[model samples]
Target chain A: MVRWEPGTAERLQKVALELFATRGYEQTTAAEIAQAVGLTERTFFRHFSDKREVLFQGQELLVQAFLDGIEAAPEDASPFEVVACALRSAATFFPDERRPHSRTRQSVIDRNPALQEREHHKLTTLATTVATALRARGVDDVAATLAAESGATVFGIAFTRWLREERSLADIAAEVLAELLTLAARALRPAR
Target chain B: MVRWEPGTAERLQKVALELFATRGYEQTTAAEIAQAVGLTERTFFRHFSDKREVLFQGQELLVQAFLDGIEAAPEDASPFEVVACALRSAATFFPDERRPHSRTRQSVIDRNPALQEREHHKLTTLATTVATALRARGVDDVAATLAAESGATVFGIAFTRWLREERSLADIAAEVLAELLTLAARALRPAR
Candidate 1:
């Protein structure tokens, strides 16, 4: 077995994003990314299943951050409260220093339909995982699902805005959550 | 070009779902589905790009139902109200007669990871399309997105329940929407 190198995945992901952004996702190769990071192709494959997997590196950690937030919430917190904590915790996963990296990563994904689909799949997974976590907290099925889905939607919209705006992800996510609540509270017209 | 058959697509979809459930989705072939429906393989290709596409045959119509719901709403309806209309409209697309079909279709998807991914993608597309329709109706971007996403979530949850319960899709969807609003209104604990 090849000895694992600390920070190897992070370094490779950074280099891969840069290459994907500059050379076009379709034109770049996993071998090229490995070479750029001064690593062998086998080592790159060790860290990621493919070039696409490299771009999606840290997806598990992102989901964990949200889950961690849920775990860190008050024992008696409401479903929305638990989700808020989870979102806030998730926000910390993307600090100011990571903004440029995220921007570049998102730009690369935006240019590729497959990447966009993968990103959407990631968010869907995040929602389901979070919902399961919420249910574990004794939140009922429907409430847990709705809150978790709402949180994922808020994160997605806020993350997109954060890429363009100067606001912090946490702040943007909070605002998005508030707006979602406001929209949800709006009265619907009577069914004809 | 071969002459179009009015009910060819629907008939093929029904037969494909039946075959996928009994014969196994992996074991079934597009040619078999077409032949079962008394048509040529070329006709099958004409209606659907491939076997996978056969399962998602009504995706466009489902999306159109949501849009039609938005269009049918009152001109001055609020964002949530507009989504309610859309969900109600969409529910009509899956009447009682369609439940068995949907149940079989969902079972096939549940057994196959690829079909599950495609189903998730379809729902994502539906959310984006509904959001765009909301925007075109003069709703702000954030409200439109939040409402559209929320609407999709409700539809998903209700659809799952509709498959198991005897209640109508529209009723289940309405209850789900109301429950979502109640969850959204719950108080959040102070951040740490």
Candidate 2:
């Protein structure tokens, strides 16, 4: 039987990121991660399916925040309003404290094609989850899909900007959302 | 030295698709595809890097059509209009005759996660290409990215509908574009 330990998952994740940043993702091993944290490989596996999953630990919370926000939105809110609110609520998931770690993780992911693919998959899943939530809220199919995808797009642009600039995620998200709405308004403007 | 043959690539693609549909994608081999086409595996490699490439043969033509349409769009066209025109022009690339083949290929791809990832990657690349084209036309970065991604979303929805229904690709594309515009208009409308 294995002994249970406190903060094993968090410790493993921090150590794994440090190792990946220093030695590169491909060169790092799960055994090395566990050894660095003074835990068994079994403990590491119990937390993350693989080393790559360490970088995506917050995905579940992000999705939940989005869904919860949509669910809690005002009943009469427009589709875009609901999505905007959901995004604003989800922004809190990435608080100021986590920004540095997220930036580091994104940098590591940027260097690897496989990690990029996984990230894209995660974003796609998030969009789908948001769409389902919208549908459940009685929004029509196409509107729900477009709103959810638009939300995902805004999140991506905001997150990238937040990483590079000093703006908060909420501020960046609000700015991006307004920009998208403006773009949409211009693009959909009636021909004279 | 291998003898050059006419229609070899087309023959290989047809034969490969047949094999994939009948025997499943994972079960089919490059050797089997070449053997069925009465060519060596060398010829198959010359035509395609791998089996999955056969399913995605039209990606290049699709990208080219989108780029050409964007380039040829009127100077006064909005980013969304440019993308709409580009999508309409690209619709011609998928006439009714090819729908049956595309439907089969899509069915095969839908069953496999790896193929879906490749398809998503291809769509992402197309969006980037379209965004680059828009940027070249003097559109701002954020708008260009949004327009291009929105176009990709429209194309995906239109293509899926075209495959399932009897509507022409152009008709389906136009309808989807209009719906997107309407969605945008409603979503972006100022709160009363």
All candidates: TM-score: 0.91, 0.93
**Candidates' chain A TM-scores:** 0.91, 0.94
Report DockQ per prediction, comma-separated. 0.66, 0.56
Once fitted onto the true fold, the runs of candidate 2 whose alpha carbons sit more than 4 angstroms away are A1-6, B1-6
Among all candidates shown, the one with the greatest DockQ:
1
* Model 2 TM-score relative to the real fold: 0.93
Question: TM-score of each model's B chain?
Answer: 0.91, 0.94
What TM-score between 0 and 1 does chain B of candidate 1 receive? 0.91
- Tens-digit per-residue lDDT, A115-156, candidate 2: 998898888999999999999999988778888888898898
Estimate, for each residue in B129-184, the C-alpha lDDT of model 1 and write its tens digit.
Answer: 99999999999999899999999999999999999998999999999999988777
Assess the local accuracy of residue B166 in candidate 1 as a C-alpha lDDT between 0 and 100. Answer: 89
Worst 10 residues of 1 chain A by lDDT: A1-10
Task: Give the alpha carbon lDDT tens digit for every residue of A54-117 in model 1.
Answer: 8886678899889889999999888888888899999888777678988999899999998898
Error of 2 at A76 (Å): 2.5
Error of 1 at B101 (Å): 1.7
The count of residue-pair clashes in candidate 2 stands at: 0
